[model samples]
Target: MPPHDHHHPILATQGLSHRFKPSGRGLHDITLSIPRGQFVVLAGPNGSGKSTLLRHFNGLLTPRAGTVWLDGVPVAADPARARRMVGLVFQDAESQIVGETVRDDIAFGPENLCWSCDAVDAAVRAAMDQLGLTHLADESPHLLSGGERRRLAIAGVLAMGPEVVMLDEPFANLDYPGIREVLRQVVAMHGQGRTILLAAHDLEKVVGHAQRLIIMDKGRIAADGPVVDVLPLVEQYDVRLPCQARLGMSVTSWLN
Candidate 1:
């Protein structure tokens, strides 16, 4: 189906660009509008600035020249407020774990926002229960399996209850089951109306799940549109499209 006429965007980047070294792989003139309740994937090969760009949406990194907006308000205008609305889950679970126990770690986000004890406790229980990690609530993150840690890291974000969730390579080193577990949690979240923005080098999981696709090359917005418009970027850039999407291509009218 084509996009409906919704005017409000939960996340928008205007002419966003960044560079570490001139002409190196960094974002440039990248503009995007992600509407609420949509699952969008930022797809590209490695070094495409997908992670860097993901950082901008949540205020971890601000554009040197352009603007990042959240819910119609420029993100730079109020970094604190913007951060509260958006949650960024880094690809590595080790990068996110900080507390001594799972429960405490999951409570970190809400606690940082000064949430009340009762609210934080309720959030901790609800997030753990939602992810089926209620039993791991007291264990150290180091003791967790890679898949469990990934889920726990995300649970930390869920405890905060942000409006938009940005995942940077959620399945980076996952085995088959770990990948499936991550995908299942993401899909479940999507069903509940949370805006999902994923940066996946592994595009297979995104083929049928993401409603919008953005392909970045070097630092530029190479392509932006529905999956129908952007899927060929895989071939154009000599990258492989997921098998499912490729299979659909033979009879998929919307594809090129």
Candidate 2:
């Protein structure tokens, strides 16, 4: 009802909780805030509620008992707006490819948002160019390599022009080169001043790229702070410290 506060955290959750009907293995009383344009790495063991927390960001999943806010407004108040503001790239790249070709895939979101045809085309072109997919615009997504497919998935999300990008286990199942490719794109996106929340079981690949590190355990935030501060606590919560960190060395970007 009032004017929007531009200074609000890009994403915030208050007492967020969700439970899988029978398993009871979901987020619990999780509370956090991610400042605009900050890159954060979320790490935890399998089933530590990392993915569930990410789902709450873009209205992909409703919290059983809590509130999600996007830009100081409750997500439930305008789910479509929340979704548009926060783009999520799933772990499985194949599952996101619905269009017959790369261009079609990238244009899907903007088209659904009812953007003009010209606008959609422009957005698709920009997204493709940013991710080095312009040459493959006409190619089939199914025909691309693992890294290309992942980049295609990200391009699709980027076309929508989300202010916040959330990636769930993006490096999962990706080979060395695939991981590096995706990592570069992720870093570039953050450099362009978009908020980044990446959840990973293996922090070795992305920890260095993040300014903050959050470790989740049993659906609760076990630790949260600057990467240099929270990183040392990861191993205490079952997350392995990055190889370099384990050796008492500074963490460096995978891109290096």
Candidate 3:
């Protein structure tokens, strides 16, 4: 059965723990609840388990000793439903493009989910239009610019009709204009009332747009709260506070 939208927390974790072999680095007792429509930024230095935690939300990686819940149901009980609810955009945009053209790429997810051909076309068209990729619908993914490629990746996820959108380092290695373009798209998605959880080491690029900030260190959640309340402690966790916050100025949107 499809999980209802009435669940208090759209996503949650309890005592979650996962340790990689040999290195023994992973999440430790992560417990948190994310309300629907919340915009959260998960920040931390490398190896802080941000990626690992996101994976658990969608059942990509099973928990070693904990539980993940989506829409009030155990994710382990219904991984397929969990994945349908949570759309994850990985750090690498290039690696996500499987189709030859932009339109084909966006339709991939819905097609795999067994949607009818008309439904797939509608979803692909809607995603491309929302991501501003309509003009490039026929273009090859290989020829897209950095910003275009990132948007394509996101469009593919959007085509899946997910309720929660999680992006891992959405803005990496892009020039200033590219960053702005991608940031705008992310903000627009959040505006549509979908829950958004973005994981990035650099907070300055996105801190302003987030309602809550979560900082992780050494595979544990070091801090989590409203962006204002968490900014002060971010540096201690190795994630730099935005320059505006450091100067006692309000963190303004990157869109400006």
Candidate 4:
């Protein structure tokens, strides 16, 4: 990891706002900051601009009203650099998979970054091992199970060695076991000290693992605070609270 100023946030948005011309589906005046090495979850109901706000983190969408800063530099000013530092794993794993085999897919990002063959190979191996995909190295990505495909998408991003990782709806279509597998990997990644931001509608799967939770509603921020503080208000924003939380029980580990 490159040395970063501890005084400044790793990522931030200042009065950021955007709207799709046709549908008017976008964020509005979203001002937030994420410190280095923090694990945060951006939670909201469907179409609440969670995805749109995340797109601005790495310059995927330019702000129409305010500014997005990455390491104190405007993301729009150096998009290439910003993207290299912030990696995104889309909700649909299939759309992002390009290589025929798992190893090839993970190597794609490093190759695009102009890394040497030896470096790319090493990165590919490390990412597979990190995500427990080493045994599936030669297997076709399309043939993998839902959990495996999600892990593959994450592996691809991990190979790029990005400073910040943002995952959108990582547990969307998975079964219980699949969700557990992905959750374990996400927890492990945070353990490794990489700043992480996960976007999801439910707090059931990842709330306990995240330190902070930011709730989005109707294209604006409704709440931003520690997970415990935000979980109680999830229902007010149209997001489902974890069953345990609803039952008045303590939120336990999803993996357990």
Instruction: Give the Cα error of residue 177 in candidate 1, in Å.
Output: 1.3
The candidates, ranked best first by lDDT, are 4, 3, 2, 1
179-211, model 4: which lDDT tens digit per residue? 999999989989888899999997888988899
Instruction: Give the per-residue lDDT digits (tens) of candidate 2, residues 1-256.
Output: 1233668998999999999978989999989998888999999999999989988899988888989999998998888998898999999999988999999999999999999999999999999999999999999998999999999999999999999999999988889999999999999999888899999989999988899999999999999999999988888898988899989998998898
Which window of ten consecutive residues has the lowest lDDT sum in model 1? 247-256
| Cα-lDDT of candidate 4 | 0.93
Estimate candidate 3's alpha-carbon lDDT, on a 0 to 1 scale.
0.92
- Clashes in model 3: which pairs? none
lDDT of 1 at 5: 33
TM-score of 3: 0.97
Q: lDDT values of the candidates? A: 0.83, 0.92, 0.92, 0.93
Candidate 2 residues lying further than 4 Å off, grouped into runs, are 1-5
Candidate ranking (TM-score, best to worst): 4, 3, 2, 1
Every model's TM-score: 0.91, 0.97, 0.97, 0.98
Which of 1 and 3 is the better model by TM-score?
Answer: 3
Model 3 per-residue lDDT at 200: 98
